[model samples]
Target: MNRLAYQYVVLRCVPRVDREEFLNVGVVVYCQAADYLQVAWQVADDRLRALHPALDVDQVRDALGFIEGVCAGDGRGGAAAGHPVGQRFGFLKAPKSTVIQPGPVHGGVTTDPAAQLQHLLGCLVG
Candidate 1:
């Protein structure tokens, strides 16, 4: 069976309207497969603030290989050919388009933790 590895960075920033609250900032590296998955994420805080931008892009790409190794359980086997990390990770998804934006939608398949985790893992192992 052929398995694939995917990775992407999620950059979150709190708009000034929120008074610059520390939101989920930085990138997340995730590897998924049919049966196993692993994710490593680093946040940008005071000590690691400066590294945020560069790390966001570079780490995310580097993470594809790292995550593949972790999922392979041997730290080997490079990324598969033609993997769409951004789309798979929702990076390319357009933001919710609505003239009158409603509050955060609570009821949704994406909000399910177990399902989300399972999907993530499946992406790494499959």
Candidate 2:
């Protein structure tokens, strides 16, 4: 079977960087052959509160929205959207100090990019 190239990273919510604690909250997948970059996220408010009771849910949700916007190439995506697919993926995979941060980038070959994205999300974030 023919296969396409794909890369992905898991997003984590780190309420306190000094504490070095985090919860897997989302996944970002990029399929270069398909020219697709999408983020799949399901924020568990309870989980966040469990880690840091004072954590703001709205802020976390908004961060997730920004990630989605970047994937959609919307105006809210800012300069990152104008970049090539690989560059955008690189931006997403970069580390951040905010509550939402990208994990390491993982690569694989898949016959179906969309299906592979869901599979990665289910396995890594869900």
Candidate 3:
């Protein structure tokens, strides 16, 4: 089997309230450096759930694409529901600055998405 390299971005929103609600309003862009066929959405529902307990899994799952595209700077659509209007939430300003250094993939891993994305890119180019 031919191994494929993929880059993914996961975005999320955390309400600064007592409940600590988490809204998954981000996207994951996965693509093979050589071809777009490998392109896919990693989505942020699971990540959001892992990060925050107040989020509804169903709603997060449904909004994965919208979140992913917006966060990835694809200019898809509006902000996540329930968030303040006109609030721009994303990490597209400086993607390279968010890259995480790879240490170990397993054994209580704590790899950040930006770093993972950069690592994937490096694997494709290196």
Best by TM-score: 2
Query: Against the correct fold, how does model 1 do in TM-score?
Result: 0.23
Residues 1-126, model 2: lDDT tens digits: 879988899999999899999999999889988888999988889988999999998999899988887888887788888788778888999989888999888899999887887888788778
Model 1, residue 22: what's the lDDT? Answer: 31
Candidate-wise lDDT, in order: 0.34, 0.88, 0.37
User: What shift in Å separates residue 44 of candidate 3 from its native position after superposition?
Assistant: 11
After TM-score superposition, the amount by which residue 118's alpha carbon in candidate 3 deviates from its true location, in angstroms, is 20
Candidate 1 residue 16 Cα shift, in angstroms, is 22
Q: Taking the tens digit of each residue's C-alpha lDDT, what string does model 1 give over 73-115?
A: 4434243212444333332222422111112212212333334
| Candidate 3 global lDDT | 0.37
TM-score head-to-head 2 vs 3, winner: 2
Cα distance off (Å), candidate 1, residue 86:
28
Native RMSD of candidate 2 (Å): 1.1
Best by lDDT: 2
Q: How does candidate 3 fare on TM-score?
A: 0.28
What does candidate 3's lDDT look like per residue over 33-72, in tens digits?
A: 4222111233345565566556666654444444444444
lDDT of 1 at 107: 20
Model 1 accuracy (lDDT, Cα): 0.34
